[model samples]
Target chain A: MSAPAQERPHLLRIGDLARATGKSSRAIHLYEELGLLQPATRSSGGFRLYEPGAVERMRWIDLLHGLGFSLQEMRGVLENWWSSEQGPAAMEELRVLFQRKLEETRESIRRHRDLERELMEGLAYLETCRACATPAAPVKGCVHCTQDHGMKEEPALVAGIMTSPEPGHRSGRGSFVRVEDIG
Target chain B: MSAPAQERPHLLRIGDLARATGKSSRAIHLYEELGLLQPATRSSGGFRLYEPGAVERMRWIDLLHGLGFSLQEMRGVLENWWSSEQGPAAMEELRVLFQRKLEETRESIRRHRDLERELMEGLAYLETCRACATPAAPVKGCVHCTQDHGMKEEPALVAGIMTSPEPGHRSGRGSFVRVEDIG
Candidate 1:
């Protein structure tokens, strides 16, 4: 705050930029090669030096990655940004791309949610058989172990069916795909 | 249902299996090579023939993929099932692996949820500027455009700053990493 705007050290060394942005030195180099970043000037020692804002630019790159923009897509967004017309049409182009990404992320979330549910079902079925002390063949096939017993929860699978498949066995019984495969 | 199990024609050709499970014929061959699936029998013409149960098994494979289980990890899970002991310890190993997968899926969901929010904010901001009839430069820099227009939502980015960064400019203001980088 004490230094005048013109008096400030306007550019940062590559090391300083990397440290400030929390990116590894190699990632910064990769970003440069991808044309995502540029140096304000080179140091006397022939090092890449960045303007004050490069820190912010690199951070945007980080966020864009999380937003599901690949490096190529990120480059495209930056290149056509605000376009030459700088009007509503330019805005629409960005809007459409973001919209697609939003849907993709939503689909990913849904898939993970289903996977979590499947894992939970497998775990719960295992829990129900915790006290089982019967013979392996019968214990693995205990019909009671699959029943709700009294709780109105989802039925668990027979562990024997999951670990090893008997020929002609339908392993998809109570599988999540039964629900997902439906339109 | 009326036919005896022994009397029923139990094997399906590779094409029939592909159609039944909605997977490509190539995928079934890959699954067989991975040892995740096996044929009930082969046809006299050397075509692969599978039991009806393979359909459910393939469906499970599809679901497991969504859960982020790589082919190797999934193969390990199937191989370890029931292990040699066929006891509680064998079950515990499955539990631990499923538990890890559940956590991974939960994390993926969380990331997508955050991305969805960021995209929604960017879209809403663009919608606000949709009505502007002012000069391109001024409209792009308008402070009012960034401020909340009485809605109880997060403020939008400063328009000029988001849409156009001058050469050597940093645009990281209000970014997710601004929150993420702090702690």
Candidate 2:
């Protein structure tokens, strides 16, 4: 009942393309201005039209942005590819670029994982405070807590919140003293 | 002989604190301007001085920045803590904040971990291209590779580079065709 796949006229007007890609028309125009995108043709009413493939291209651009490539850098990447004298050279350059990004991504994961653990431990330490016997104690009292939550030392994330270095003490290590020791 | 621990004058001038914390003096001043930091006192010469604990505070601020807290939000956090009528109320508010941040951090880790895998798989796919038989082949030939490097399908990251959707095809799924099918 429907037209065959090869017989379909699949051009999308700019608005349709923007909606398909979940990007604003302004963003699509910016991509066009940057030479990162192009219209496949124009409609009879003078509206720009794009191939459905433009959606995939827009998504590819977004993925590269997520991977930390600036628009200018992405433009440079395309230029580098097209201008390369041979396929192997372009492929080698891309391989190196991807390799560096992978290393950076791994390092970012490491840092976030470390913070994840810190937040978990800090939350566990705070759980004991919910049933505090001295809920009325001054907030500053937390630095030198005497209520005996039974932890040997405060988690650094929580300790950072509750303590300041004692005035007139030169020791860099002084700030990390146990909450009980401070008390 | 070294001065007795109790008798030491441990105040650090702004420049010394900046060097110790690896922050510029301007950054320390900006933190002060934002009311997120303060001087412990002023030296006789009118230079700002800080307690050694200020270093720990600066590090804490950096950690918070890493966790995506802006300076204004950090100021609000301090205000919330001090304005609380009781310690338990303050701790409860902080507990909620940390719980949300922990969730966000976990999400960030998941996204980055996904990207890490994509890059690794993309790199592995590229490895086969290193010894490409037709190093002199037009770069576009990669989209419908005929050399039989033995990949069943292109990784999305790599396919994204090689192909554009064929014009006049309405299928959203048309862009992801295998290399052999496209050829």
Candidate 3:
């Protein structure tokens, strides 16, 4: 007597899977080798076939990968999903992990901001130096002055003074001149 | 007809500088070669001598190095300070540069946190799978059903189920099982 035939499970070819999961055929093959995924069956022509739920499984893997999980880590997670009897504990653990990661990210942001402040201050100094090279009389009664000397004077000390004039001035200078004061 | 005597600048020998700046004599020489610093003069015996302020400048360089600034960048900043007529402009440019570096560092930290989260989740799933390997009962309801019912049942259908029982199991033979009511 012939044995009764069983109903076949849902199956999809490699091309169909690639399109559905937005992954390349090569990547699918790689995942199978890593034991991260399994094909339901093979056709007479030796083409790989996936079951009905394979797409969902692939989606989960893709999401984890996007979140920076390694292929090995994803395999472990899938294994837990497949064999664990208590689902709540696993889900809880996952939530805790996410929270910890968020905290670390916030700390990193704080350190980066501190470094940013330091660099900004450095840049400000360069701008001030460039402005001083201009051939203008010192601002009289400016906030930088100790005394309120409002009267302007002629540029008599221009010869003795080591000046870093603006670009294209009479002195063909390559380097900036270190001057203690503009006046 | 002797020329008028020029005022001599204060100078420090290599060993004296090492003591003042807490740097090795070799390091001081390296700094001189890199142009990050300079000695005030050379002795008759070819020994190097530094000005009083040289130690202070070296200390500043050390500070910037600790903060992760490259020698080249430090040199550029120092050159600007030595040559620039305006201190404020140079400081401003430095501030902007620091801000850019801070942003890059923050991005790196964010990526690290994401990776950490993925790893933690993966580890949690592995733990649950290990717990569910031993079947508590002969045949429990489907794993998916248990997840929906809010019951803590052994994971039997999930992929990557642990083959060995967890530590401290009395019987240590059957699969870990926890059945939950689907309804």
| Local distance difference test, each candidate | 0.59, 0.71, 0.49
lDDT of 2: 0.71
Q: Write the per-residue lDDT of candidate 3 for residues B25-88, one digit (tens) a residue.
A: 8887676656666544454444555566665577666656645678777666556544554444
lDDT of candidate 1 over A49-80, digit per residue (tens): 56776776776787778766787677667666
Candidate 1 residue spans exceeding 4 A from truth? A1-10, A135-183, B1-8, B133-183
Mind giving the per-residue lDDT tens digits that candidate 2 earns over B119-174? 88878877888889888876766666766556687666666565553222222322
In candidate 1, what are the lDDT values of residues B1-25, reduced to their tens digit? 3221232267577777787778898
Off by over 4 Å in 3: A1-12, A19-22, A51-55, A105-183, B1-183
Candidate No. with top DockQ: 2
The Cα error of candidate 1 at residue B131, in Å, is 3.3
Backbone clash total for model 2 is 0
Sort every candidate by DockQ, greatest first. Answer: 2, 1, 3
In model 1 chain A, which range of ten residues has the least summed lDDT? A173-182
Worst 10 residues of 2 chain A by lDDT: A165-174
Q: Best candidate per lDDT, number?
A: 2
Which 10-residue window in model 3 chain B sums to the lowest lDDT? B164-173
Report the error of model 3 at residue B31, Å: 18
| lDDT by residue (tens digit), candidate 3, A1-183 | 211112233467777778887899899887776666665555544556566466666765665564546888766655554455555455445446545544654665565455545444444433343445432333221213332122242111111011111112122223322222211
Off by over 4 Å in 2: A1-8, A44-46, A150-152, A164-183, B1-8, B164-183
